[model samples]
Target: MVDSIRQYLSWYGFLFSLGLALVWVLMRIAAIARADVSRYFVDRLMLWISIGVVFGGRLGYVVLYEPEEFLAHPVRILSLDAGGMSFHGGLIGASLAVFLLGRASGYSLWALADIASSSAPIGLLCGRIGNFMNGEMYGPPTTLPWGVVFPSPGPERRHPTQLYEMLTEGVLLLVLLYPLNFSSWSRRHLGSLFGLFLIFYALVRIAIEPLRADNWNYQLAGVAVTAGQIYSLPMIAVGLVILGRSLSAARLRDRV
Candidate 1:
């Protein structure tokens, strides 16, 4: 019993799931509490968007990475109970929800995106912690002292890459988004925050793919990649285009 308990602790069990649930609840609470005046805060919108993200993310995982198995059992694709969701798909789904909501409510798409971006890190940080608990995306062989001996089927010590991502894409992004609200940067160019968030996230995710444990993407021209990186490239490109347009608009506004 003691050994089982110790293994559970080291493996990161229910504690991780609890952390995600806690953050999600807190975000809902925050939306409810701030709904009085903040255009960005809406309980229904948040709930719907969350649903879209989870559903889309799961579908994307099967469609992009494991289509063969899913093809064999089409019904299993919808069974998220087994656990598989792609971050890129979730982003796309959430963005679609936001777009629809924004158009209906007369809110700017990027402005809504900015509001969502601020809250993104919370989910990301929690999700990575959950990943650490699951021991699914462990890193390649490493001689570093901090290397983890995962109770996973492998005997090799690997880098805690998930934690690394949590720090950069989650914690650091949150810090960056805070001061951005007070700055005039976005005011001059609406969507600057959103664009930057997407671009930065894509760059960071792509940079970390090399350290990933598995090469889950198709190889193109002798370059091995992962599904995560492939999905991220479009985000970076779109962000760059948005950034350029924002700058041009700002310049035109100044001229006018």
Candidate 2:
């Protein structure tokens, strides 16, 4: 048991917790560093949301797909350093925290969502790179020149899908959202840019997942399609709904 535990921790620990910690610290610093909405209250709210994200993400991952693994070693669930987390779970957690915090702060949820969305990609990029370093979430086998040879489970040339996601969902997402700053869409609808960010990233993620390596975590329409894809569907749907609603509202406001 000791050797098994040691091996598991050695293989899957460090990067997991460190990635989250770094992101969390950066987010808080960014919030405080910014003059736009810097306030004690805002900082407090962000703290609460961060707590929610960490807790919710861990619990959600276990509940959603790895109940047995977590249940067998209940303590390990809290050991994020041992890895095994779901981005979808973290998103849900963050969203829930944002909603609750927004309400408590007497702020529009959409506006807060927009702010959260704006700075999110940078943090995501960091996390994905961490994922790559940890050799956790990698892509399927590939003969491409850019394919990376992840050193875990089995050594083979695989798509560095996580990095692809980091660029698209993180860096590219930020670039796409930047236009909102000058466009009337952002000022008018507030969350319109954020909505587009979500939709765009989810769409890109759907495409990226196919290239990812097949693992036990992958699952599909009651079958198996990869956990990454399965988790992205709802985000795509929600983003679409938000985008559609925001557009209609903008149109109505313009007519008025």
Candidate 3:
């Protein structure tokens, strides 16, 4: 069943693009329900976010993962056909777009961020599933019963880290955040959901880093730490700061 699905996905390049489309739809729905924003605003926001995700994800992958190669062939930066994207980069780009749009539209930045964050897990889920279908992002060898034998890495059974992320970062996150998005308290606190999203995603990525095989070259000073883990540390810290500030502001408002 899994192989058949993978073959189907391979036959047509739909899963990743489908994921983006779903994300856009989810965001638009969220904007209407949560913010009651106009159609024009939603359309504009989606456009900016799409641009951010593509350019930012590509640039991030180039700079962080393969700077030397990209520098040697700079034109390859525009060639997304080669397939490299960084989630962290996309998050940064999307956040920037949200911030900019919020400023221009006179909407609350935190509120817009909350809406995006709430819908982000859907994208993560789809992207990880796409990775699984493509047989990429498999983890190190494992003797576990459920371990999968991916095509590129040759016969040894490996932990399906993409599926792991699909569960933790995608399914779990969506379950956790989606309800909070509709909660009165979360709405009042504004960026609380976004803060939690960051903290949870970073923690999960850090936890899953040890299982992944591709980050060996990015290990830190002979330690087992991968670049993803290193990048995630800041996310955790920032999440904590944002969560704290949002809660504090909410409390202050309540007291007034």
Candidate 4:
């Protein structure tokens, strides 16, 4: 089984399957909740989102982590797999894609956001697993029994922060949001689920900041900051604003 799997398995293949599954599952959930997204529009949305994530993630990584390298060879941005991709970048790209898709397709923006947000955990789960397999996002050295000695990083036992994120942002988030997808309240609340997604994701990421931040920590002046925390802070504020506005709107509608 291991030999056969090795022959056929590639990171790209796994990613493609996961991306397709994420979109398909999202459409199904939206249908279950009766979102206004059409089958035709979704097909286009998926295509655009795939392109956006790949391009944006790569660009984000270069811009944020390796500006010098980018300045040295601007054309290197064209290489999707030249190095690690950034989630923050992918998020920006996906958001733009969703906005464009929603506008062009005449679908409800919040509805698309809600569906996309909920289904994102599926992709996160896959992405985190990919990170683990690639030996890129492991945490600091650990004495814990479950820590893995990644081939690329070293022989030191490090926390599997990638798996930690999979559990927190992927599994737990899915469980939390699954119920909302079926609710009459959720449908009316519009951006509520999306808002909650951003909030929950930020919270979870911050929680794991210490773990994943080991390799990617940044220091400025005299302070240390994790890249995840930096990106997540603004998102938390954005989530709060969204939730606040959504609740206020819901309240007004209730009075009507």
Q: Pick by lDDT: which candidate is best?
A: 3
Local distance difference test, candidate 4: 0.78
Candidate 4 RMSD computed on C-alpha atoms after optimal superposition onto the true structure: 4.1
lDDT of 1 at 62: 82
The local distance difference test score of each candidate is 0.72, 0.69, 0.82, 0.78
So what's the TM-score on candidate 2? 0.79
Pairs in steric clash, model 4: none
Looking at model 4, how many pairs of residues clash?
0
Model 1 misplaced stretches (Cα beyond 4 Å): 1-41, 78-83
lDDT of 4 by residue, 51-104 (tens): 888778878899877789879988766554555578888889888989987887
TM-score of each: 0.83, 0.79, 0.90, 0.88
CA RMSD of all predictions: 4.9, 3.9, 4.1, 4.1
Task: Put down candidate 3 lDDT per residue, 171-192, tens digits, no spaces.
Answer: 9999999777556777788889
Pairwise lDDT winner, candidates 2 and 4: 4
Off by over 4 Å in 4: 1-9, 78-82, 220-222
lDDT of 1 by residue, 48-79 (tens): 67777777788878877788898898877655
* Winner of 2 and 3 under lDDT: 3
